[model samples]
Target: MPKLKTRKAAKKRYKTIGGKRFIRRKAFKGHLLEKKSPKQKKNLAKPVIVSKQDTKAIRIMLVC
Candidate 1:
């Protein structure tokens, strides 16, 4: 059987916890921060857990 390759882009975007699940950065914080409130920016910095519906596909990309 051929080896299943890991998707490099996905590798960079998602992080795993104990090889069981994934966490990812929240969107909308990438740019244009001046208009956003300090509290909103602070909350955006925190990582969010991948939704169960999306976890299956991400796991495949992660090859976890």
Candidate 2:
């Protein structure tokens, strides 16, 4: 049987730590910053874990 290949895009954007997948947060470094609150800006800097429902699909894509 052929080896399963990992998704290149998923590999670049997602990271796995202790078998958990973390995705980079959006809208923090981009435009429209003035409309957002200070706490929102701070929170956006942190990475978000992939939801449990989606974790299985991401794991397959990540091949981790």
Candidate 3:
């Protein structure tokens, strides 16, 4: 059988603490910071868990 390859792009974008769950950075944090409030910016700084619906696909891409 051929070796399964991990998707490099998915590797860079997500991190799994353990098991199948993946942590990813929140969006809207990259730009337009000036207009964003302090609290909102702070909240956006944290990473969030990927939803259950998306977890399956990500697991396949990550080859977990």
Off by over 4 Å in 2: 20-23, 26-29
**Top-TM-score structure, candidate number:** 1
**lDDT per model vs. reference:** 0.92, 0.78, 0.94
Error of 3 at 12 (Å): 0.7
Lowest summed lDDT over 10 consecutive residues: which window, candidate 1? 14-23
Cα deviation at 8, candidate 1, in Å, is 0.5
lDDT of 1 at 3: 75
Question: For model 3, what is the error of residue 38's alpha carbon versus the real structure, in angstroms, after optimal superposition?
Answer: 0.5
lDDT at position 23, candidate 1: 93
lDDT of prediction 2: 0.78
Q: How many clashes in candidate 2? A: 0
Ranking by TM-score: 1, 3, 2
Better of 2 and 3 by TM-score: 3
lDDT of 1 by residue, 14-52 (tens): 999867778999999999999999999999999998888
Sequence-dependent TM-score of model 3: 0.88
The TM-score values for the models, in the order shown, are: 0.90, 0.70, 0.88
Candidate 2 has its poorest 10 consecutive residues by lDDT at 20-29
